[model samples]
Target: MKIGDTYFSADVETDGPIPGPYSMLSFALVYAGQYDGQTFEKPSKYDQIFYREIKPISENYEVEALNINQLDRERLQREGASPKDAMNDAWDWVMSLAGETKPVLAAYPVSFDWTWLYWYFIAFSDKGSPFGYSRCFDIKTAVSIKANLPFSSAGRSKLPDWLQPEREHTHFAVDDAIEQAEIFAKIAEWKA
Candidate 1:
């Protein structure tokens, strides 16, 4: 039987502005819900999730970026999972969660998270990215269009009270992913 699309809300913490040059320090993917064309079934509990901290791929990094997420690169280099292992595990988890359905990566803006994830998956996973090269859902853009606001004004801080997520916006990758997933579900259910 054909199943619905499974949306995984994603968030990545990087050591710098981009991948390769810097590194994806950590990341998270939380299963939000499923949509079978007509109806969206939001997860009863946001417990289905995957998270990993990855060793730096390169020595290059920015101090400013590190200050934001506060991930110690040196410590990660010694204790974190290797890129190859992390990506492979993430790919496997995503596939298992999706089962027969198509998996879509959802994020607040999508561009930044997608960039890092796509690059890492291509560079590390033998099977490549689970979302292919493109399947992504941008919650920011969705809200902008749905609420008839300009893209610049779509940031979380400016969202209507009803559109704001109930979860706290901690910078931690998993926390942010869960928060964004909540926003995505609310957007999906909103009437406009």
Candidate 2:
């Protein structure tokens, strides 16, 4: 691992309640211990983390998630790529990370992001996922069970021994990825 580098957290931000037929918009990767939540950051440094905004089919749109993005129109005009194109990019990114022992995807809400990505991969590739992995590790669930707390506990906990000093603004992709990373680090640190 290089010093002063982002920790290659894989993430996909979308405009929907669940990630299925919905378009993926505004993908980002943040460097841990670099810019992270401490400063303004963008997706220029993660060598293995790739992201793309895709135009979703009609069945993919979810009104609630669309409002969360707050950039549906702007993204459509600028960053929007076809679903196939974005999927291809993401698939390549996964292949690049094949070096990892278990080929992990760390995310806060794995149920949502993992499912959405799987659907897109199958649809885009016209086959099963190219990554050849069947399971994903949910960092949030790890943290929750490790500390024996609820998902909301992360927002309220403040003890460093329990967690890494309580991170804030953990809904967006980068921040959530960081949260997941924190849990992974702790798990590794304690040899759990």
Candidate 3:
């Protein structure tokens, strides 16, 4: 990879609360833009995007989770892409957009998304994880720090009007990803 770093806003919809035991139904990545270790910039339009729906690895799932993502489990079983293929394609797209810059995965709550993503990448892709083990950004933590609020208060409702996006946070992977990407940029560029 390159010497610099790029921030990739990522989101995933899963059938359950955890990886291994659950299945990731869909995932999306939005290359918000590069962060030169000091400054942040928004991408021009919808420049970088990656999205996929994967076949379930297990029969187990939660109805609430499915409802949240608005995905049809039966349809996914019949038409979803292979996990290995999807992960490979995702890695390729991330790499192409990153160029020489190291890709840094960012999520609203990194723990949940990172768990599924890292596990899937390692479990399915021979290329291993594109973001490696340590490169990750947590929007919640960043916003909490920037806003000088306690971590528990960093939820969306606590954010100021300027930081929150107007888009509805529909659980569709790509739409939520784009929404989170905007929030990430705002916090990253925030002076306070």
- Top lDDT hit: 1
Q: Which number leads on TM-score? A: 1
> 151, model 2: CA deviation in Å?
6.6
lDDT of 3 by residue, 1-192 (tens): 226788888999999998888899999999888877666778876457899999999989999998888898899999999999999998898889888889999998888889999999999986888999878999999988888889999987678888988587888888888888889888877777
TM-score of 3: 0.96
Q: What lDDT does candidate 1 reach at residue 130?
A: 100
1-192 in candidate 2: lDDT tens per residue?
322222334466676655554566655433322222234233333333355656655545667776666556455756578877777776665545443323445455566667766777787754456434555556666666666777777432432466562465444665555555555555434434
Off by over 4 Å in 2: 1-8, 28-48, 59-63, 77-79, 130-133, 150-162, 165-172
Q: What are the Cα lDDT values of the candidates?
A: 0.94, 0.54, 0.88
User: Given candidate 2, what's the lDDT at residue 190?
Assistant: 46
What RMSD does each model have against the real structure?
0.9, 7.2, 1.6
Where is model 3 more than 4 Å wrong at Cα?
A: none
TM-score of each: 0.98, 0.66, 0.96
Order of the predicted models by TM-score, top scorer first: 1, 3, 2
lDDT of 3: 0.88
